[model samples]
Target: MEVYSERQRISNAVEVLKERQLTVGLVPTMGALHEGHLALVRRALDDNDIVVVSVFVNPTQFDNQDDLEKYPRTLKHDVALLEEVDRERILVYAPSVEDIYEGNTISQKFDFDGLEYEMEGKFRSGHFDGVGTIVKRFFEIIKPHKAYFGEKDFQQLQIIKKLVEKNNIPVAIIGCEIYRETNGLAMSSRNVRLKPEYKEVAPFIYKTLLAAKDKFGIESASEVVKWVESQFSKQDLLRLEYFIIADTNTLKPVEEKTNKKSYRAFIAVYADDIRLIDNIALN
Candidate 1:
């Protein structure tokens, strides 16, 4: 597959593909390709005529400097994996900070209908604003027919949906399923950062989720949250950040049940400084 390192070149190439009457699909990523990323590419391939995978580790999105510094950047290996997916149909856009931001280095603000007020938003200040800025830039540059994102970042997915809705962007925002390992840890680029022994303990996060799912059907949100906290407390390696069962759409904690609404459980933990987040459908 061909790779473009310039934003204008990416825009021009996508425009050329448009001229060919091709439906472009965009899968924005932060490199260090895994099965989860390839899954998005495959889904994009099925639904669109051409898929453009972006591999830029957006600096703006990370609130922690060390987190951004530690974030993996394996372009050579990432492209090698993409080559296995489908070289002819995929165009890898591995741009630099200068390429994406274009030296427009200034603070920006964005609102996702109060989405950034809770959960990750409550924790990571200005995180989604950075996400919104970069994603907004990607949309403006790529102009894809459809953009694919995994539901693992369900909150970010909701935020992007809000952005698209508020801006009236002409494109479909497709959220794919969360891919997992056989032992049940959610597939993440950060998974590679886990220490060898810690990786063995990481699957407990999912095991806890599975158990929480079962308990959620019979227990209250408060009760489940307490149980989740207790589970994390027992393991010195895992520190629970926040566990809540909330309205899927509104993302507010749901104390009272509604028959028609959807509910989900979102959990974040620090597996010895390597934070991992995962969620599951409760109903």
Candidate 2:
């Protein structure tokens, strides 16, 4: 439960841990701690001698300023949650924007071998760039041996893997399974912003994903898209933004299963102003 807002202090602390040859794990996050995030932390704790959960609401990732402002910042609550996880092994790094970006909060451009031009990238212009920038900065700052990421943002997870590959970063990147609610709705920080009515209907997104998963191998990938679209069309409360069955590796939308490659359904839906995204693997 030691929390550090200054980069230099945390860096120094991490350096000391490294000198002791203690294995360190990094769990990068944007505040608003949910069970989804804690799952990553708990796993990191299991795998490493120490876990550092960075809670900084990154500004560069948001294409819309309103969304950035509205994005929850709950470091105090987040720390409390981490303290509950394990007070001694978990170190919380809650940095300010100025502390993270050093006054200029602009994101760096990355190619990601055109991996950035897909689903989330197409919608949130500089989103992955911001993600890469911040995550890279954390890797530099923390220098952890292992890092954990949830598969909820499967595309982003792929991009991060590419980031490490491109830069030759030494850290091992781990993607954990998506944590869902008892009703099947994917756990998300944005779930806090869902309207009461929207909350009731939000579980439909996962229900449709489950059905789409069922149809993935049987139906054409394009047909699965159509079925998902029709299912969402019948619902008036939530709007389906985009749903594509993409290869688990390259993330290119496929019309039919080819070459024994794995595929997964990636979706983004709007519960009014709050956007929710989820994915499920299709084999």
Candidate 3:
């Protein structure tokens, strides 16, 4: 794999690829290699002639300094996995923060308005703005025919889709399925931070959402909330942040008997400081 750290070199390489009439696929990531991330890379490889995976731990996205500091950085392992995927066709761009941002430090803020104030947004204020800024920059730089993102971050996928549509970005944004473990816990890079005991209980987050889906038939939103809350309350180790069953698209809170075309149960909890988020679809 050809590794480029500077923008000029990467741009030149992309130009060379374009000269050969190759369709480029970009998989933007923050550098901790996991099966979920690999799923995105594999999808990109299948759809495009050339695949470029950029690994830059974006500093702006994290609201907590400690979280950012502790965020996993396994560049060595990450590249090894990518190389195994397709060494000849894959290009790894691991740029420094300064190289990616330069003096263009101003964040691209969104009035995502109501959409920005719930679930993940509520907890991580200005997070999507940071996500928007970096993603926009990456889109401009790569100018790929398509970009792949994981559905593990459903809200993030929605935000990126909105950004592309509203701004008229040309690249085709694709979202892959949420990769999960054998136990049903949605695969996440942050899963590494969970304590040994917490890891065992982590799958319950998924279980609770599954239960909520079946409970929906017999219970109201209020009742679901009560039951889920009690379930979490029983586990002293699990600190529930929000247990919401809302309109999957707009993410607005749903009331009793309000049926929608699509619905989702989103939950966020802190298992001893390792915050995990998961959602399940209720059709």
Q: In model 1, which runs have C-alpha deviations exceeding 4 angstroms?
A: none
Clashing pairs in 2: none
| Model 2 weakest 10-residue run by lDDT | 254-263
* Candidate 3 displacement at residue 174 in angstroms: 0.9
TM-score of candidate 3 on Cα atoms, chains taken together: 0.95
Assess candidate 1 and give its lDDT: 0.91
Per-residue alpha-carbon lDDT of candidate 1 for residues 72-92, written as tens digits (9 for 90 to 100): 999999999999989899998
- Per-model TM-score, in order, reads 0.98, 0.98, 0.95
Question: What is the model-wide C-alpha lDDT for candidate 2?
Answer: 0.93
> Residue by residue across 18-85, what tens digits does model 3's lDDT show?
88999999999999988888889999999999999999888888899899899998888999999888
Q: What's model 2's lDDT at 59?
A: 90
lDDT winner between candidates 1 and 2: 2
Stretches of candidate 2 above 4 Å error?
none
Query: What TM-score does candidate 1 reach?
Result: 0.98
| Candidates in descending TM-score order | 2, 1, 3
Residue runs of model 3 more than 4 Å from their true location after superposition: 103-106, 256-260
The lDDT-based order of candidates, best leading, equals: 2, 1, 3
